[model samples]
Target chain A: MSSSSAAPTAKPPMRDALVAAAFRLFLDRGYEQTTVDDIVALAGVGRRSFFRYFPSKEDVVFPDHERCLTDMTAFLAGGEDEEHDPVARVCDAARMVLRMYAENPTFSVQRYRLTRRVPGLRAYELSVVWRYERALAEYLRSRFAGQTDGTLRADVIAAAVVAAHNNALRSWLRSDGEGDAGTLVDHALGHVQRAFGRPADAPVRAVPVRALPDEGDERPEDVVVLVSRRDAPVWRVVQEWEAALGRA
Target chain B: MSSSSAAPTAKPPMRDALVAAAFRLFLDRGYEQTTVDDIVALAGVGRRSFFRYFPSKEDVVFPDHERCLTDMTAFLAGGEDEEHDPVARVCDAARMVLRMYAENPTFSVQRYRLTRRVPGLRAYELSVVWRYERALAEYLRSRFAGQTDGTLRADVIAAAVVAAHNNALRSWLRSDGEGDAGTLVDHALGHVQRAFGRPADAPVRAVPVRALPDEGDERPEDVVVLVSRRDAPVWRVVQEWEAALGRA
Candidate 1:
């Protein structure tokens, strides 16, 4: 076969190298103890190269987040097909994010731990999460434009999706890579889908219809009343409903 | 009245004084350039007293989030009668948080600016937010014990409520304290309420009825099929729906 499968030499990208080095140093020396100098030295890269790859030490820990944000923005922007469904498009976008973490499980795990211990990294991670929610909200706003209260609905949906993803990811990380995280994410997203979508029709219920009073009759049953309290007790509200229905 | 009225000599809480001082210093010297010593000195409180009020410098910049979290937890835990309707209770709990911020608009705005510019304060704020979500999710899990896939639903609901609050709060903050934030929060929570709760019996098209096929009746319309594609073109999907309904 003329050695058709000759070995190919490939080198890690500067960004990836820096990220790997940062993760290692963060784990070995603790996030606060580790400095940019130590990371550049460990990665065998120049200070300028390090700076080019990351704006600061914290940036080294999360190199791909900006790229992921951009990719998610693009995906949401490209979602013009209604057949794909807003819910499905959102799920697919979330899957893209999960796949990004899965692609670098070690780095993600380490980053997760570092974020837990380091306040600065945790804030940075939150900003990244906020960006994700913003992108999702923007996409949803377009999809549900005509619906009443569309902006609020979009914000809620985006937040729910991100929370599901975070919850599933946290569980996977806590288990030390023992579970099927992808499946868990799907299950989580399913919860989100059901929350906003309509439920399947329930079994039909047949009940006898009641006669209404004559329009000119001036009795209490002749007039219907509706009362609502936003913060009233549920049972009290139910009682009010029953009373208003003349069944109390 | 013979001068029987008591004098109005009560000042803002020591904590509030420290927060005001810290905020002023943050504005003047930048958040990073300010120190705990300077804040206590400006607030005219001893270092021990400052520690008694706030555990750390970053703590002074935030509202009493810990107190709010505790109140929320207590409110959620006290849901003896309304345990079945967690959605309502969760909304109420979230409103409590919103009200806390609204009560102190000046401090809230200052803290918001500091959080935006200071990474450490921002992380502390995120941690507080995460705690709120966790408390909400726990309450929801308890309420939805018998339901299938309850945990995920609970988590998503918590996330949605938090997101709505944040969205409304951010809008209020960015607008320089203009507008009715309480009304906005109510509108936001209403979106969440409708998402998980049943819709009102507003008039809508009646669902199509499907009759069961009798034996030996091989009508194509009797056996309905549904095919959904993740990335199908919207027009194609709509056309398929129309075809299935015999509209085209």
Candidate 2:
């Protein structure tokens, strides 16, 4: 209710101040003990200002998530390239959030610890994560609309992208955000991409196909065979067929 | 606060009474409007009994999820069968939850609608879903321990299973819990099994080898190559390979 604190109601400065003050209080006095009054007083802002920036004490803890989710949705939405692999595109969209976490390693790590300790905040974080996953799924579902098991493929790939992203993100957070999160996320996404990417076309190109000539005129066409390790990516098989049709 | 209400402190009856009363009040007067005292008074149970059964008003709205999650964890933990396909094992485990929802269609549907309206409850439900997914992931990771990309594969498969199950479950609930959820879930899980099952090992086995035929090699080993549509299930490919191998 202070007049001087209310003077600077212009967003970024006041919002950032409240967030800084809130996190400091959350770290020093713990999340439950820290009140809105405490955050506003520390930030030299009014209660109204705090409310303007964040609706609740819990909201202050996760200030960037809304923006991050919006950014991710936009990333997925803008992906209209015909040649872009849906799986890879989704994984790239997931990386947008990872980049958000990577931008503020210290704050992200601190928030991660706080959220883990507070059940309500943890639940809120899960909801946010779900939103990101849904955005990815919706995009993939549109791309795979009429294909066989398209819906299943969309849901699974989306879930896989989210899981892989979190696996990397959580691993980094568990290490107190010490390592290269970009690399971890890339490595994680790579696993998903190889497993479920482009059906079977891309990977099949990497495998060598043989045209073995047949002896008898009755069986005049050459026998085309592909021999790969038992664990080759599905794409390798898919690509070979595409190649076979092209040759025929 | 009434003495008559405080008379019956026996656990199970008291807990069930509280849940029943709370739901009735929640339906009649909305969740936020109904207080703990109102619930206890209606149930004819002590406030202590209400607290014992549920920690909060939000907890009452979601009475069975905790028990269901625990049951799912137990189901996954008991997977000692070497003969069961890991993917099928998980699909069966997911069925336990579907059965829980199917047992009380109206209640489940009501809860689903309520959760969609309430942000906090939706968040709580997401957390519960995450726990279910974690249980599935843990079971799969244990089964695929040393294989390449085992952890990623396990996590992805678990996520896919959970996603597919939810897709079916939600579609059923969206129809006001009409139709057979069991059949819907079976169809959904069938999609997942077809895409990622291990009937012929993983999807990596169909890569081609570079075998240009020697011009004079007469009637060289009959190159038995099985060609199927690119969209064929991994299991079908594996079965075909198995049958081919058998014939050979």
Candidate 3:
């Protein structure tokens, strides 16, 4: 490799330089036509440097995914607390993926276009997406372990999160990353959250997700059923609750 | 080249013969070691016959997926009426894939084992799965074209159906294709239906998410009741319960 072109590599990280050079050649020539040797030569780096940054040519086309997937796994694992609604937590995890793309609109849009035309790259991208779905599923499965149809629920919700995020993310990329991706993704993930998230007034709230610190555990007297008269107005019950609690 | 051996090709369909021979060779030898020539020779068929039935060596390992994907697309498209719940329709569409695998349990089990060993085959299987998911998504997009977040909802539900179906299907396959695959897949797909399918008597509510009041979609006597621990701070329960009642 020539030392003349190597000056730029010292400025931008060698990894970024390799990606930049690889994309330049891929766009100029084709993905298949651009060899690793050609990329390293253009980037003024050794073959070892190229391999160090990315395992393969296809990976260069979509860098940062490994890091993003790691971040997503960590984000999902961080939601270990029972109160963090699992479905909503997964939806939020999917949002981190969107942010990865949204953070680099131009590069992501470019990569999206490139990945579409190449069948091998498209398949590779699908595999990467599958890994992300699996991560979310693993997290959800642990959370829903004992529930009826737990594994199915976990897999379905995980796939739903990825699908919703990708649908909106792809739309944004198709438009050249022109719109508000957060709103679009949130709108999409909202469907999954509501469809799978626990009900706000779930009567099985004996161990409510939002239980107060004061309520250590349920006791005999904790079953306070006011059994309001069926005909009683809602406001009257509210008043009785207020009075019974000595808060009136 | 022997006429006596070639006679068998005329007896069995060339496609089935090719698949049977390919798998036998794949197991006896290795997938990479067994080439198209080896399969054709074992099947007592010519290269032309093998190529006519399967597009490539990898295609032989997954002989039924193309036909299954086409059938799935057609099945999804046939659900044209508005009365049909799109989510449930897609779930049924995924069941067609399970039936295809379950129809030939031994072959399905063998293929699943082979696929897990080969990275290329796994990626190919994933691509085939991706096509099935896309078909469902397309049908859903059309069915939910104008509704709020229709595209997002369609995509999410479609992926959920595919994920849930595959989760159960793989579990059955992993068990050496034991037990009833239909029952297992049905249980898994049931999650998708319950999560995303519109209720049979669903009213025209703008948001058809979870109406978690059991059969009572909108009960007039819906009330919130919170029972604090006897020794608990009453103010905490009062405040939190007020917030909960406010939502009700």
**lDDT of candidate 3 over B39-145, digit per residue (tens):** 99999989999888788899989887776776677787789788787878888888888888998999999999999999989899999989998899899999998
Residue B57: error of model 3 in Å?
Answer: 1.1
True contacts kept of each: 0.38, 0.42, 0.60
Q: Name the regions of candidate 2 deviating beyond 4 angstroms.
A: A1-11, A81-83, A146-150, A199-233, A236-248, B1-16, B200-208, B213-248
Query: Model 3 off-target regions past 4 Å?
Result: A1-12, A200-248, B1-12, B202-248
A1-248 per-residue lDDT for model 1 (tens digits)? 11111323222377678888888888888999988889889989888998876789878777767667777778877886676578667877888788777766776777788888987787788878877877888899899899987777788888899988888888888776566879889888877765554223222221222336577866423222222222222223223333434442
**Model 2 TM-score?**
0.79
After superposition, which runs of candidate 1 have C-alpha atoms over 4 Å from their true positions? A1-11, A80-84, A117-120, A142-147, A197-248, B1-12, B27-34, B80-84, B113-121, B145-147, B173-180, B197-216, B219-248
**For candidate 3 chain B, which ten residues in a row score worst on lDDT?**
B202-211
Candidate number achieving the greatest TM-score relative to the actual structure: 2
**Cα distance off (Å), candidate 3, residue A194:** 1.3
Full ranking by TM-score: 2, 3, 1
DockQ: the better of candidates 1 and 2: 2
Write the residue-wise lDDT of candidate 1 on B4-33 in tens digits.
113232224686688788888999999999
